[model samples]
Target: MESHLLEVLVCPLCKSKLDHNREQQQLVCKADQLAFPIRDGIPLMLQSEAISLSSSET
Candidate 1:
């Protein structure tokens, strides 16, 4: 993902900043415990498209 894009992207739920997980290719919202997938360099920010994050994830 581009750094510029990541800087502007936020969680759709909490509107908090997202963390980039390069290996996983997803944007993570720690506050909301959700991971928005980045497919083909595009972020899917919808709640229904997000993956529930386990407490173990950070």
Candidate 2:
């Protein structure tokens, strides 16, 4: 994703800033403990599509 897009993107649930995980290709919302998927270069920001973070991830 572009830097500009990442700057503007936020967690859909908590509306908090997201940290980009380049290795995992995910947008992580620490506050919500959710990892939104980045599929085919597109971010799936929907809450329903978000994956709950593991204990180690939190």
Candidate 3:
């Protein structure tokens, strides 16, 4: 994801800032315990597309 884009992207549910996980290719919303997928550098910000984060992952 582009730096500018990442700066503007937030969790659809909580509207909190997302942390970029480059290794996992995801944009994680810590507050919501969700991890939005990034496919080919494009973030899927939709709530339906977000995966729930496990305790260990957080």
Best by TM-score: 1
TM-score of 1: 0.95
Worst 10 residues of 1 by lDDT: 2-11
Q: What stretches of model 1 exceed 4 Å from their correct place?
A: none
Return the TM-score for candidate 2, rounded to 2 decimals: 0.92
Query: What lDDT does candidate 2 reach at residue 16?
Result: 97
lDDT values, one for every candidate: 0.93, 0.92, 0.91
For model 2, the superposed segments whose C-alpha errors exceed 4 Å read none
54: Cα error in model 3, Å: 1.5
True lDDT of residue 27, candidate 1: 97
Candidate 2, residue 26: lDDT: 94
Worst 10 residues of 3 by lDDT: 40-49
Error of 3 at 35 (Å): 0.1
Show how many residue pairs clash in every candidate, following the order shown.
Answer: 0, 0, 0
In model 2, pairs of residues that clash are none
Q: Score candidate 3 by lDDT.
A: 0.91
What would the per-residue lDDT of candidate 2 be over residues 1-58, giving only the tens digit for each residue? 8899999999988799999998999999999889999999999999889999976985
